[model samples]
Target chain A: MTYVKPLPELTHEDRPFWEAAREHRFILPRCRDCGHIWFPPYSSCQKCLSFDREWIEASGRGTVWGYTIMCQPYVPGYADEMPYNVVLVELEEGPLLYSNLVGVPDEEIRPDIPVEAFFDDVTDDFTLIRFRPRNRTGE
Target chain B: MSKAEFSGRTAIVGIATSDFKALYGTDPERTREDLATHAIRDALDDAGLKKEQVDGLITGGTVHYEPLAYRAGLTDVRFCVDYPSAGRMCPMALMHAAQAVENGLANYVVLFNSLCFRSNQVKFGMGGGWMGTGLLYDSVYGMASPGAQYSLAFTRYQHLYGGTEEQLGAIPVAFRKHAQLNPVAIMQNSMTIEDYLAARYIAQPLRLFDYCLVNDGAVAYVVTSAERARDLKQKPVMIGGTAGRANFREWYVDLDFWADACASMKRDLMDPLGVGTDDIDSVQVYDNFSVSVLWGLEGFGFAPKGQGLEWIQDGRIELGGELPINTSGGMLSEAYLQGWNQHAESVRQLRGQAGPRQIPDCQRILYWGLSALPSASLLYVD
Candidate 1:
């Protein structure tokens, strides 16, 4: 089946982040004044309430902060993917990003598992930031 | 922090839950107005107060204000406002109503929540409206409603705090057992921990058994000053104290599992009323998901953090045990009134009206829900 999943509803402020993802680079809004970073793309710094922000590339290296498996297909387009896992990967930059942990089995999934981001160009307009387990030796 | 001066000044003089069908979609014809008016009239009757005496009204969860007041025959309600709907607004409505009455803004206030998820499943249930507005951006990953959020949090909690799915089964089992004594509860069929394990998982680490029922229902509470409660027909359940804080660190997730907010409210609300966890005869927690029960207990100082799973075992949270929780079966087995009925349950426990589920010497009760900004941590006294 074609992709029937709910896509991100992006506003102008949230566009740059996804636009960067389309280029296989993950970016986030950094407050120029306070050096605070955030995810899912907000306009201003949640801390210090500053609008002085610079969009920069993120390392996209993160650890598995937490994960959950969907035993029931609650959303549209997920019926065939029952029991799949959605993970919260806390990037080294300290912002938690929501993505799927690919190339790993359910039992192997646990917190603090090292993972690295890989971009998936889902459609002509959107590229999602997903993750896969990273091995030692920096491979 | 010092004790709030508003402590013990206002009391819940009346409480009633609307008659609900046994299950969702069974009563699709019942309108929201009828449900709200029924509970409001019943609550007013319980306090022996005329509808004209109610000058303040607060509503939650799909309940609009002006039409409801007109249908309920409440005239000249001076203070009318619609609080946000969902589990969190349950106690906030009660606290707001009490503040209005205590501050002399109104002589008597009625707070009601009418959830009609049955008739409007697409709007309330299937559409993901019940989950707060943020965090939908990750829907591509199959991250559905708040259940999945709890699953992720509970998954991390299991890693850090060491709780097992087997031990977590006790929460739903205990609440279902309590439902056997609550005549008004919808899911009164008895369940066991083994049965809990057998149930299908809605989200991993959280089963179908762990979720609250999504049935149609409404609940109302009559609020008045303690001085005015002296002449009421029923024993008034005094509003001893209330405190609240934001539990969010991320957009919508509490990575602490509501520990900080729970502890903050416990110190501010309970201590000021001269009550502790032991002194609290019962607790009514927001059981939108069963894990929240343990989260609330641990954060509110009933059990040490990371030990609630151990503390809740072996009928400890059951009725007549150390601290009976969700005695009206809560939203788990009882109808989901969006935590509104739990407030009524606390009031009933304090008034010694919980029937066979009543706690002995129930002098004090706590109604708490872990929530974002403007949450509620309320205490009631007999």
Candidate 2:
């Protein structure tokens, strides 16, 4: 795994999301008043418009929603990883996370495919959570 | 206000566009000049008015100032405004201009758009001082390409809807198929669902075909009172309703869905226009990306959340489907000149002037535009 520097500055609103990456935990915000979980950790819940929220750890289990196979290599750094599968994985908690699907061929990314998260240690500082197809084995 | 409240009042009296082509060779300022001039001439000819009659001008020039005054031949227009609002917000400017006219503040208003910067930089590497605000905080993430940002929504939609990748691929296939019939479309070749599914991915969840073609082109429109429309060459399609919307930010936030985009459009624009999605026979949806179209469809209540893929795959949005969308091939097949062509195409359909790709007896058109922002309009002819 290779480390990639985020091109933009990290703001206070999303600082927790990036900070959690160092500890290898996928963290998000949960409304303190309504008990609703928010992804990417916002200051308030879009539902009740309440600013009271807490950081909640997710189960990290979700299903592959939809994905696309990128042919053109626009970004110079990831050109070697051309035609990679980028997917949106829907967490059971209701927030959708944008991630890359690893350990699966580009053809396998479809709707409702069971998936789970695994950490990709790109570098000591930057660790990305990539999803992989869940195998139902020994049942 | 009611949707049809502006009936027999505001009308698009003029329309013009540049030669739709790749943006590699020409400078953005030159292309803007060509398109703005063409539109000005067309509007003057249709309205039977001279340059001196034009009193208002609005341009999407927030990033750069070259095209606003110097490039566009507007020497002494009374009211001139410029902003870096998203390309889709151009109609909001027109809506404002219409109200200005209704208030008797201006006689004639011009709205201009030029989309030639990206492809120019791609063909030849970007030179000094070409950065804009969108590239600042929004596209700061290296993975935040247009395709990548929209993929967040597409992924969530498919997760909630039970749609397969092949189903999502079907959208581009259908768009390209319709493009084959539109002579103005930049991409005229036939594409299939298999071809779409098989294409390589640009960002995760967004395939090569799922994105829009970036090219150099410009579009302009003139708005005048309905009282003055009958004196023009073509039948004036009345502007029934128009509204602009914005969220906290357009970047990839946690909740991929744009709730404001969904609610305000229904309450402020479409419902007031006296036409629901069913009442409108056709649409000129801004298809900047296949995913953006899906978002618009869901937000505009064309389909339920996550059901856009199924609606598209089941042929509900095809050319002859119950509701035909992007009849002008959309930005997906046509040039993505900031989605202004869709506005021009909607006017053509409303005037009964769309030659081959025209829908039969179409009296209403819903034009939806999306840049880094969202805005919509409903047009009708009686």
Backbone Cα, N, C clashes tallied per candidate: 0, 17
Q: What is the DockQ (computed on Cα atoms) for candidate 2?
A: 0.24
Off by over 4 Å in 1: A136-139, B21-24, B122-136
Model 1 TM-score on a 0 to 1 scale: 0.95
Cα lDDT for residue A94, candidate 1: 90
Note the Cα lDDT for every prediction shown.
0.80, 0.68
Report the number of the highest-lDDT candidate.
Answer: 1
Best by TM-score: 1
Give one digit per residue, the lDDT tens place, for model 2 in B46-98. 55667767788777663243455555555667777775646567567778778
lDDT of 2 at A10: 51
Task: Please write out the lDDT profile of model 1 over residues B1-382, one tens digit for every residue.
Answer: 2356777788889988965544356555777777888888899999999998889999985767888877777777899989866668866777788778866799899888887776766332122322234335567677776777778888899999897999998899999998899877888788988999999988787899988887787888898999999999988787876677874555345888888887778777877666777787788888888988888888888889899999999999999789888998888988888778888888888877878988988887787776455255565664
RMSD for each of the candidates: 2.1, 5.3
Model 2 residue runs over 4 Å out of place are A1-71, A85-121, A124-139, B1-4, B21-30, B62-67, B70-73, B122-142, B159-174, B177-181, B192-199, B203-206, B245-260, B294-321, B370-372
lDDT score of residue A25 within candidate 2: 88
